[model samples]
Target: MQKQDFYQSLVKQAQALISGERNVIANMANLSALLFTSLEDINWAGFYLVDSPDELVLGPFQGNPACIRIPVGKGVCGTAAHAKETQLVEDVHAFDGHIACDAASNSEIVIPVFKNGEVFAVLDIDSPSLARFDEADRDGLQALVRCFELTLS
Candidate 1:
């Protein structure tokens, strides 16, 4: 399927998976699994939740083990959280301070999830191919983040 079409379906699937689920952990777990299994060439897909003002604790994921703790502004995940904006890196090596949770990951996209206008968590996806993400992915993943926000009270 085309990238756009795939993400459209992904958003629907994500919404359906989280429907009627109020538990945050459960939702993040399911969402991570959904993205990991559905997306192509991805080495990791998961979440890092804001555990403190300057740190993000690893949450649910569907991939190899990852860094358990990341300081704010440290890596792609932390940068997104600290900036409260999406960080789409076409080349992980080119990104200064890029965290190498998985050496195989060449590209990455991290979208910060907001709760009441504050960064709550981040949806992180990593691919093994260079320049794996584009504007389409950004828009699609951002939409998925919106779906996640709906689950919040």
Candidate 2:
């Protein structure tokens, strides 16, 4: 299947999995599993919730254990939450201030998950391959996050 079609299908599945589920933790858990299982070449998929102005706490995840806490503006996940924008890194080793929670993760994509117009958490996915995520993944994942945001209201 084409990348766009694959992502669209993933987004639809994400919506179906979390539809009518108001709990953030439960939704995050399901979404993590969904992404981890559906996406190829990915080693990690999970959430880092904004616990404070400068810190993020690990949430539901599927993969090797990750860093328990990350400070804002520190890593890809932290940068996404801090800037409230998506950070797609083709090479984690080249990224400044990268925190290597898993040595196997060579690339990553982090998207901010908003609640009430403010970022509440970040959806983070990692891959062992270089340039694993692309614009299609970003756009589709953003759409999927929008569906999750709806459940918060």
Candidate 3:
């Protein structure tokens, strides 16, 4: 499917999921699966939620066993939380202190989630191909994150 069409389908699915009666975790997991399946050349798609002790706890995801704990500013996911912005890293190895949950992940994108203007968590995606993500992905995933945020409250 075209990128735009995929994004629109994602939005529609997210809206329905959020509007349904399932719990947040289920919704998030469904969203992760949707993203993982819709996007091409992706190896990981999931979320890392903030824990009570001010650390990121692994949340719903569709990938291999990943790093269990990530500090507030460590890897791509953590950096997105700390910086409170979306990051599109075309080369994961080139990123200073990149965390290798999966060595095969050559590129990544992390979008920060917010609740009341405070950083809550992140929607992270990883790909095995370099430069797999671009401006269209950044915008589409950001929109996807926004749809997720609406379900939080």
For all candidates, what are the clash counts?
0, 0, 0
Per-residue lDDT of 141 in model 2: 88
The sequence of per-residue lDDT tens digits that candidate 2 reaches over residues 1-153 is 998898889889988999888888999999999999999999999999999998999999999999999999998999898888999999999999999999999999999999889999999999999999999999988988888889987
TM-score of each: 0.97, 0.98, 0.94
Question: Looking at candidate 2, what is the lDDT of residue 94?
Answer: 99
Clashing pairs in 2: none
lDDT measured at residue 122 in model 3 versus the true structure, 0 to 100: 90
Error of 2 at 60 (Å): 0.4
Which runs of model 2 end up more than 4 angstroms from their true locations?
none
Off by over 4 Å in 3: 52-54
Decide which is better by TM-score, 2 or 3.
2
Give a tens-digit lDDT track for model 3, residues 1-153: 878777878888778767754477887789888887877899999999988535798999998889989988888988888889999999999999899999899999999988788887899999999999998889888888898788776
Worst 10-residue lDDT window for candidate 1 reads 1-10
lDDT of 2 at 102: 100
Give the clashing pairs for model 1. Answer: none
What does each candidate score in C-alpha RMSD? 0.8, 0.7, 1.4
